[model samples]
Target chain A: MHLNYYQKEDQVLLAVDCIIFGFDKENLKILLIKRNFEPEKGKWSLIGGFLKKNENLDEAAVRVLETLTGLNDIYLEQIHTYSKIDRDPGQRTISVAYFALIDVDSHHFDGIQIDAAHWFDIKEAPNLIFDHNEMVQKAKARLKRRALSKPIGFELLPEKFTMRQLQNLYESILDKKLDKRNFINKINSLDVLIKLDEKDMSVSRKGAYLYVFDKDKYEKKVEEDGFIFKI
Target chain B: MHLNYYQKEDQVLLAVDCIIFGFDKENLKILLIKRNFEPEKGKWSLIGGFLKKNENLDEAAVRVLETLTGLNDIYLEQIHTYSKIDRDPGQRTISVAYFALIDVDSHHFDGIQIDAAHWFDIKEAPNLIFDHNEMVQKAKARLKRRALSKPIGFELLPEKFTMRQLQNLYESILDKKLDKRNFINKINSLDVLIKLDEKDMSVSRKGAYLYVFDKDKYEKKVEEDGFIFKI
Candidate 1:
């Protein structure tokens, strides 16, 4: 079965990088890895690895994320491909950047020692390695646009959250002010939130009522008529 | 000068398959090529090619479109990457799909001998060669979503287009009946269109006012305060 039909064409390595996004109470943070490879060794970078021959791109992304964060079955999306000639100084490689959303408290992760991997406030994140800064910027932009139309924000928040918590997540990612009345009014109109009798008493003495996202109701509402969750 | 680190890593043969989207006076059509190579010889396929070492993915996509249709500098976007194992029987090829919108009447193309490249109405498009049909479907869905938020539909239309033609393009792609007043209201709010002094008497007796897309004004308006062109 060995043949020369493919022998002439160029063969190279492909890599997958994951931009892990997490929402902490009122701020958005991205999980960044400290590089452990040559050419850009000891610099802050996204969690990434070279793709193996047998694995497809999706499988490679999932494998890299799992190997890095040790979490599986999380929400991940392939956002864009970065294929500049000198994108990776180590070699000629094309990378597909995937942005992932996860509930911060849900996943358990161990930090890589010496080589620094930690959460940075997205607004004040450090200058990243290589073209990773550009990838991060693109991922943030995609998330901001996606959050406007879909209920993906829930993925970043805990299962049960206060309306104020949800609004703060929106404000942090968009980096702009939103009218409190208008924001709450928009969310309430959607009618996909199940108000719990419990209250989040930490922030204010006059605690805000806690609410859980009703996925069934959201899907039903979408099927009946499209609803844009704009803030 | 022949020292170390100047060597390029093994480079993969990057390929770009453009889902060339076009809208005629009536239906939506996609441009395709009949395969000429050994693995899948003589099969319906998307217009595509392997990237030369010097070019970027966008450049490769443009080159393929131009060589196939004698057109260049088309409106294109990299939608997603297809790297499923055995997705391409020829080799373990990683192909990136670009969604290109073009005006159907502008290009004067002659079919190649071995490659029977042709345009088929979206409804009647044949079963494409490989994973191309899946790529086409994804591109169409992405285009439909994009048409709502952006004024890219103008790229698929003639320079001075009637309002009816614009509305029909949306309806055909989305396969939904739109109310006249509601559609007009949504479009007017975006303020991206410049109503020309001329009228197109061909479509109707009353003559719809021909409109052109104002790129500069749209950019300025979006920067000042964003507007969403919802479908």
Candidate 2:
């Protein structure tokens, strides 16, 4: 066989860990699960699973997220790979961390109680097991950067939302207050949002105009005009 | 034995591949090596090696890059991880791709003719084996994006360079023609460059002023003022 070249190479377990982000119209939250296994039993940890031989990292991440959350087709991005020799004390494992964004009210948890999993406001997240804490921090930083340059924030917002709602989402992800006028100017400059005729009157008697991210138009503009999205 | 939790997990071979970029004052280039072993013998490929048991991915990447280039302290960034089934014909391997930037003239190969390794202009590089081409493309896109928002381009240039040199480097990486006036204004607005009292008289009679990236000042500004670098 022509396999001698790779015969002596070390094989290590590959795991996929997910940092799932949710926006409940007010705060940025992360989903975490309590460990049920021996190494770190009862400790908080990111939802994760080992990669099977047939599936790729992306598939593994999606499968792991779905298995834990009972949700499907969530927006997942592979952020970074962690490979410290002793990262996972129970085994020699390298984990590829993925971040996902979901609107809190939009996705249902398939009517089953996921007792181990719970949502934590990003700021109040408990200490996670292994290198999972570092993984969450890195994923959060990536989310902040992506939110600034891409229209990804829309994933965490309802289809129709007021401008204040959009700014609030950005503020939560960025962890800082943005000047409202400047925020509006920048969003308008992107020219990828559609102002709908409907208004959200729940918060105020003089309702605020609602807007939705026009993904199709945004993608078409990027393809045809080489539009680079930036905030 | 408390090992049953992870005993049945699949372990696969891991590899580290590097997309090494260099600039020789006039153009951007990539380093490629001819594969000497089986499965893809004689094919051009990125410098890569199998991961070992003791080292983390970063250390493994640095070791692999140093082994092939005979250079150390090169600036390396982990760009992405590739894990598609059948990616490597000889074995199932997950490869983490890292991109490195080095000033071509500043470092010399430790003097034994590494005839297998060569630098090709970024635009003129040959077809690479086993998804290496895709890795290169992704790395180039990252470099372009990083150059616009960070001072990383300085790693590919001499300590002091003329404004035209810096602009050329950006143009080459971006693969676009930028307006000279706009490029200069944007770079100057970042306030991370120190215009030297000295001038480079090599290119023209009325010499252009040379500038050095002020790393210390840039860091201080970022720390104290929360300055964001953009160009």
Off by over 4 Å in 2: A111-113, A220-231, B111-113, B205-207, B219-231
Write the residue-wise lDDT of candidate 2 on B90-141 in tens digits: 9999999999998888988752226788989999999999999999999998
Q: Is the docking of candidate 1 incorrect, acceptable, medium or high quality?
A: acceptable
Give me the candidate number with maximum DockQ: 2
Positional deviation of A11 in candidate 1, in angstroms?
A: 2.0
Number of clashes in every candidate structure?
0, 0
Q: What is the TM-score of chain B in candidate 1?
A: 0.86
Root-mean-square deviation of every model: 3.3, 2.7
Error of 1 at B99 (Å): 0.8
Question: Chain B, TM-score, each prediction?
Answer: 0.86, 0.92
Top TM-score model: 2
A208, model 2: CA deviation in Å?
3.5
Tens-place lDDT per residue, model 1, B1-231, is: 211332432334567899988888567788887776667777888998776667677888888888777777688899998888778777777899998888788756753432477888888898887799899989988887666655656678888887788888888787788988898888777778999999988767988899988888666654542335656
TM-score of each: 0.90, 0.93
Candidate 1 structure quality by residue, lDDT tens digits, A29-148? 898877765777778899887677678888988888877777788888899988887787766678899999987777777533323568888887888887898999899888876666
True contacts kept of 1: 0.33
